[model samples]
Target: MRQPALITFAVLCLPFLLHSVAARAQPEPQSTGSDSDIAITDFSKPSSPGRTFAARTVINAPVQKLCGILLDYPEYPAFMPNTDNASVIQAADDFAIVNMTLKLPLGKIKKYRLRLEPRNTPQTCHLSWKQVPWEDLKADDTIADTSGYWHLVPHPANPARTVVDYFVYADPGYVPFGFRWIVDILSKESLPKTLESLRARAAELP
Candidate 1:
């Protein structure tokens, strides 16, 4: 009887162990743990092959308020830092195609177009995107590739608050091999400021 219960317990715990292993295998960038407001993490290594980041914040605003901010695709540069321009090429109630030009720290301009899909529920919305080849440049001309999602989850206990999460992966295409460190440094240095700016902007919204 004892042996059977022990085996059953072990079997029940396997999935959790696997989850911990997987999380450790792809360790998120280290950061100060969050309390209730905002926390951010970004992978920044001089020799790393790609850039990835995730940010989480609590905003004292409703989901629809942030939904409007995100879907106003053409005005992204007005509030999103380092973005020089954004244009919505096609649009619908639930999706859009957008083009963006990014002014890199080294001053190279990278342009890419992406498809965005918005999924909304009663109190939450998720906006996700992936890069697509555009006419002005080949797939290799801009940053190599990118994909990400922004999720707004209403706080379970606080009806007036929402938890916002942004996750992104970016690969630089035209970046010079020797100077990739510049990109790494900039990504790390800029992410916190970007999150702060977003928090400030959202807080200002009605």
Candidate 2:
């Protein structure tokens, strides 16, 4: 079942729905440690009416290594919070189709498939994606489709260290998004936890 744009837009455009807030508030650093400094921001600002938001950090790993970690879908549940399991059902050098099951903050478990496309260049690599149809999921109808990106840009002076950005835009169809409490709780769990875990993983790798 296709989700209506109104609901998706409403959830995305929450802060700007009435345009009451003029400037988007930057999120404080979620955690700080010797491995890396991780920061998350609400890119879905009042300046722009969209669902996209980003998590950023600087790691002691090279861009290539970082990309490899991101593509290792099967390991997500180990580090990323709320993610129950993830597997790459199909993949090639340039693209991959992954199946994921996640437990939302409110204890709602949903499954979906994503088609990931990677773009590579000499110094930078980025992956962008959208939902895909997958028969094994048995979840397309109940859960809303979602999309986002992962960006890796290496430090010019320190090539071995890289700056990473993770963006996620989701719409939980028919879910009670209007409940600010649920939104607040899930917000604290999802992206922030993912970045924290990712930073730890990158630092631990040799």
Candidate 3:
């Protein structure tokens, strides 16, 4: 009788122990953490062939507000860091072709055309863009290739706030030996500033 009682007690406690272990293994919740915190993962290292960087941050604004700011491509230069000019070349309801000029370090400028698409679901809003070649426009210099996406979803613990995920990769092809840092900055260092700019812009909204 005593042995059977001990075995039953051990079985009862096993479930709770397993549950605690699983909960500890889960990722930290953004809502419960600092709102100003930005998490970045760099995958552009030589060992990682992906050549991309990913970042995550929590914004105080809702997804709808952020969506409006992102979809307004023509106004990007006003708020987007390093953007010198942006214009909509062609547009449809769901997609648009936009030409952007970026002011890089040391007076370097890159002009590129991008095709952007907006997507909305019940739970998330997504904006994705990739570089596209344009024949009719003249540019001082064009970047080799660039692509990225922004994912905005309602916070699980707070629907009024948003969780943002940024993914991007850029290839500035054939840089001088002295200017190699430019590639590093474009692919990695500039991520935090880009995300922070969007957060600040959304906060300015009414």
Candidate 2: segments with Cα more than 4 A from true spot: 1-36, 45-50, 135-142, 177-189
Q: What TM-score, over all chains together, does every model reach?
A: 0.75, 0.69, 0.78
Question: How big is the positional error of residue 91 in model 1, measured in Å on the Cα after superposition?
Answer: 1.4
For candidate 1, the per-residue lDDT at 145 reads 75
Prediction 1 global C-alpha lDDT: 0.74
User: How would you encode candidate 1's per-residue C-alpha lDDT over 15-104 as one tens digit per residue?
Assistant: 999999997885343444553545667654668666878767777777778777887888778778778899998999878899998776
> In candidate 1, which residue ranges exceed 4 Å CA deviation?
1-37, 42-48, 138-141, 185-190
Q: After superposition, how far is residue 197 of candidate 2 from its true place, in Å?
A: 1.0
Report clashes for each candidate as comma-separated counts: 0, 0, 0
* Residue 39 Cα positional deviation in candidate 1, in Å, after optimal superposition: 2.6
Per-residue CA lDDT of model 2 for 123-149, tens digit only, reads 887888888776655433335556777
Q: List the residue pairs that clash in candidate 2.
A: none
**How does each model score on lDDT?**
0.74, 0.70, 0.83
- Report the number of the highest-lDDT candidate: 3
lDDT of 3: 0.83
